[model samples]
Target: MGLPWYRVHTVVLNDPGRLLSVHIMHTALVAGWAGSMALYELAVFDPSDPVLDPMWRQGMFVIPFMTRLGITNSWGGWSITGGTITNPGIWSYEGVAGAHIVFSGLCFLAAIWHWVYWDLEIFCDERTGKPSLDLPKIFGIHLFLSGVACFGFGAFHVTGLYGPGIWVSDPYGLTGRVQSVNPAWGVEGFDPFVPGGIASHHIAAGTLGILAGLFHLSVRPPQRLYKGLRMGNIETVLSSSIAAVFFAAFVVAGTMWYGSATTPIELFGPTRYQWDQGYFQQEIYRRVGAGLAENQSLSEAWSKIPEKLAFYDYIGNNPAKGGLFRAGSMDNGDGIAVGWLGHPIFRDKEGRELFVRRMPTFFETFPVVLVDGDGIVRADVPFRRAESKYSVE
Candidate 1:
């Protein structure tokens, strides 16, 4: 049976309630970042700077840059763009201008989102901090700008400081869109700080939101969200406080654990690991294939560890147990054509390996010519191989 009605309701309310709380917090942080950036560009820095106008748009901006993220409709496999940023990510596609452009564009918009709130905070509430994840006056700019401040500071830490035309080692992806920015704007810089894709990223952003929510949600002369705990008739106390913390933690863990940050084992678990590993494996496959096209066998090229590891690791071959390979060789003639080259039990040829037994052990031996008897004789060794060469004819 599925569940009782009461149990189902309990599950639904608690889980769904948590989810809704998380979503709101996420959007608020992002929106705050976005709105803050807009205000910063337009009002604080004399105007929306007109140069980064593209950031004004939303997700659509990411479409063209999907390839850099190892994503594409046809998976056209990336190649070097013949350009090098002296301090580029050795493993990231940020080295390429196209991907850099797309990611940078995303960050640009994010920057504007945060900047706009700065203007709001400065203009609206000169004395009070705006209510954000946990600021002072909920409506005041203090909280809003603080979220913006955290994000901006984070972004600056990631992307700025790298001079013009230099490939940045943007570990954090905060200044992700720095490449997309025009040189005229002079926003590009080396951001050695604020690395990205860690569990901490979500945690930090969440904490910022929590702080904003606390200050905003708890303030008197409330914003009637009806989404908070009520301390008094019109006053709202941190209604979603606990949920907010959980939401942030979940977001951090979820994003890191989810597809966004696939570790090496996850991507090439059966083979390679992580996106970088996948890319490297793909490169290896390409190179190995090219070598095989000439004279090399595919077995010598492609990695066999994944295939062998999974099969044998899962299946048993213990002395006390039975397996695909028992005690003796699977083939005849000792199954080991011993000589000077290659494994006696196996072939160097591609596809031929399919016929070879992986579980069986192959062995044979050769004779030591005893001139005293006018002939040669042999002794058996567990790992010996069969002799095939003689010139009696």
Candidate 2:
């Protein structure tokens, strides 16, 4: 009843050459991705309209697949006969920061994978025959070093060491501070700096990865240990199930405790507010009237409004302007939420102005309207403000 000779061959869990190949491959792919992103960030980034920027909006290798599945679309606007129409859906700063964190995460994971493979190869070699190096000790040292890097990166994001104005939002009014959004203000901390959050996740995963690697290095059980543990045993099954249940309970308890805790504004900067649609509408109306009196088109006047708001946002959110840090020091939030107004305006079939209240849910056709030579709202489109409310708890 014994197994056949060919079937009894040992399964090779670790091969030095194969592991080295995988490590090289992983490094190459990660490096390539990082390089492409760097090029886009530095040489190709366009601050004025990042959505239309070739560098910022360029998709990775997998983007085509996503686009085919109707998951993503080109982030740009259309040009009409009178003026250019920009896509209101795209937010440049948010998009860039998001891409950075995502790529950084991929590289982090690759590093961990390489380390694991190296450790495994060393472990297999040591167990099979005598190796010159102290593999276990070396593996532990590597784990410690990797853990430090992960911790440092995580701390950097948490402290906003990279740049000022990189803050998180606290909608529950946990953080008593408020941020200015150009002509108005709203609650901050709704969206945090992406890198900071990514760093935290990386640190957690890295810690677990290192721990598992170290545990394997420290505990090299003999073949007898595997033989003694019978999978089909009722006692073994009961013990494993009990341990799983306890672990699940611990996770649930920890999540609930964290949720109930007060918002940590100190760890992540204080919450800031932004200008709502009402304020933006008032400003727009004034500016548009002035432009009309001067014989300027609505598109031309509206175009300058964003630029003006952006300048104001910079001044208000600048850490030097009595923010969280000192005047000379740079310690402000990312200011992405400040300068620009949300909501895109379109035209109806009858040439009436249509302001989108919220983000578009699906593809819907809307007419595009243009102001006539006479400084009048084409089709007498009435101006309206998008509703936004604030409260303190």
Candidate 3:
């Protein structure tokens, strides 16, 4: 009473010309190009530098003329120190690995797209000398599967299971027991760099692609209907409904995964003080003040600086205990420290406080002051620790 599986196979095999259409080839090429671009982006974009900042702050780009907005608060600053001057921090292998997995999924979807297009096109039946089953009517089902595969790959990659390394060795460990592979990159806590966060956009995009494919299939007519209502029409509606249900499920599942995977780790020790706006503003004033007070040129200050302060461990250690003391030498070889009073309270004999109103050029390269050995700032100042040279090598 029902059509058997062999009949379906016979229908597909009999229509050889349908397997190679101009439209199918074009769609395959487009899908392939998209997949290639995804891989290219993953390879060239270093997450530590300015190139990857845009992706991290996805929607911040449209504010017009605020292109460098993402870099304003030193968000693009090097996460680690050591290595050559050109490479200050360790490369983010997690990001690279995640990108590769997402790209693989895209490639898989592209291949599936080709297969669906090739097999679903209308073709004459060799048995009856007429068009047999309307194969294109089932395109929605294949499209839905392709979308699911895309989402699954992205989800798997974000879990760190599919990547070269794991995000956390023991994800279920106690807060203090958990350890990140790289602490310099700050992957220890619940951060956006987690797999779920990175893969979310990819999953959303895949879901939308599936929805579009389903819509396209719904609009295409398999055969003429009686008063525009027939069994084929019912099949199209049912397929679209099933696609919608799957899409909803994916959305819910992705949300749940992200929420659970990104929960913050409660450490046994005091909370680390992350850099914030207030801290930056205070440090800026202090460094500038010291430079102006000493009348030291930037190059002069840089030359006098020691090397210990260049490493992240120097700054990141014991963040909760008042954190690292932020200060930098001015371009004019002067050192500054932020004072509580508006005017420098502890002024030199010349009435100059250890504060500067203006910042020097190349301030980022200015030496970070670990300690103020002498009460008064001077060009030949003694620093407990300093980073005079670039940490590239």
Candidate 4:
């Protein structure tokens, strides 16, 4: 049924103006989400408070180009390292939130502009006398742009080899020899930009994205292809999108759970099993407990801390073996520890000690099925060390 003149003038309906209105509404929704995220980051941010634990803390997403030039969240007050940063700018929580707010404002303005020009027939196709949009072309353009960005960052080793301030705290404070968060998956030592670790991963992904974008842009997809992909109709498209969302979700979940290289140790923190009732949080609690027990003065107890790796023996079910395993004691031919056991450390202004990050323990690092001298498997292995029943038996 056709709408009345008054209704059509005042409200949006199934007309040419509806396309413009939908665009405006979509922009507004995106703006709202960005604004909300900014607010949430602001709410959680506390400059005065210090999170001593290195494993768990608020995370920030930094641009590769900006970070490569040493523009990052170097504000040391938020973490255990307390001091003024040498090269700090709009890369911290405050800066990211502000950027989001600015983006949201721009989106809102664009939405308003679209709303004002709702009656425009710019999108109307001359042949059909109806609005038409090239969604595939737009997607291809987006992919191309994203691929270029990723390729530029990864190929140049923007964050790992070049940027010192991102992985570690206060790049200028220390010597030029800077190590990455996961050196095994990154360039190590004072080598000048050798791209092989996580950089390779990014480069591969970027290349694929670029190729996909080019294919979409140059070639007109066949009807059979659209039908095969379940994108022939709006209903099929929606269902396919839902399936894609779930598939992506499961992939991410598996990566995080298994602690794959995709979820880098530097960016997303350690795996769930490593920290969830395992060594990470346990060591932190043990240190605090020791501090409370030893010191008589209640006021000065927190300030006076225990040494790093001090209370390792006290943790776990079997205290006799201790938290760390010695490679020297073993009768193996190589007599060398294989895994990268290093973790990020938090320090004071004068480079004095504060706390050490607890990475994976000996048993977790090297999965050894203990064997007796008589070529038989030993029964007394500390498989499940912690009291928490979550760990593997």
| The candidate that achieves the highest lDDT relative to the unseen native structure | 4
Model 2 bad stretches (over 4 Å): 1-14, 40-146, 156-214, 220-360, 367-393
Residue pairs that clash (backbone atoms under 3 angstroms), model 4: none
Q: Please give, for residues 1-393, the per-residue lDDT of candidate 3 as tens digits.
A: 666974443333434444333334545565455445544544443334221122222211111111111111112343212112333222232233344456556555655565565543345556666644444445566677777776664554443345322223123212111222221223433354353343554466568768966875777654565335553443454567679889988865554334333222111111123122233334444565577679986545434332211111122222222214533211112212221222222334454444322212223333322223343333322233253331211
Error of 3 at 145 (Å): 2.4
What overall lDDT goes with each candidate model?
0.32, 0.39, 0.37, 0.45
Tens-digit per-residue lDDT, 1-393, candidate 1: 688764443332323223334444455565455444433322222112111111111112222222223321211222223222354343333233344444545655555555443334333334554422222343345445556655543344323432221222222111222231221212222221212332234336645865775566566555564334343321222334556678878865553343232211111111111232333334444666677886877656443323322221211211122333544321121232122232222222231221111222221222322111222322222222444232111
TM per model?
Answer: 0.28, 0.33, 0.28, 0.51
Worst 10 residues of 3 by lDDT: 64-73
lDDT of 4: 0.45
lDDT of 4 by residue, 42-105 (tens): 4643333222211112333232222333333534324223345555554654465466667767
**In angstroms, what RMSD does candidate 1 have relative to the true structure?**
21.3
Tens digits of per-residue lDDT for model 2 on 1-393?
A: 676676332222133434344545556566556545544433432334322121112222232222211122124332111133455244232343346456656666665566465544353545666323433454566566676666554444334453221223343212322121111112322223222344455456567756766775687545576347643233454466579779978865543333211222222112222222233345556777898889987767666664433332233222123433333212222323323553255554666564423212121322222343343334322232222121001
RMSD of each: 21.3, 17.4, 17.6, 14.7
Model 2 per-residue lDDT at 77: 36
Instruction: Report how far residue 22 has shifted in candidate 4, in Å.
Output: 5.3
Ranking by lDDT: 4, 2, 3, 1
Worst 10 residues of 1 by lDDT: 50-59
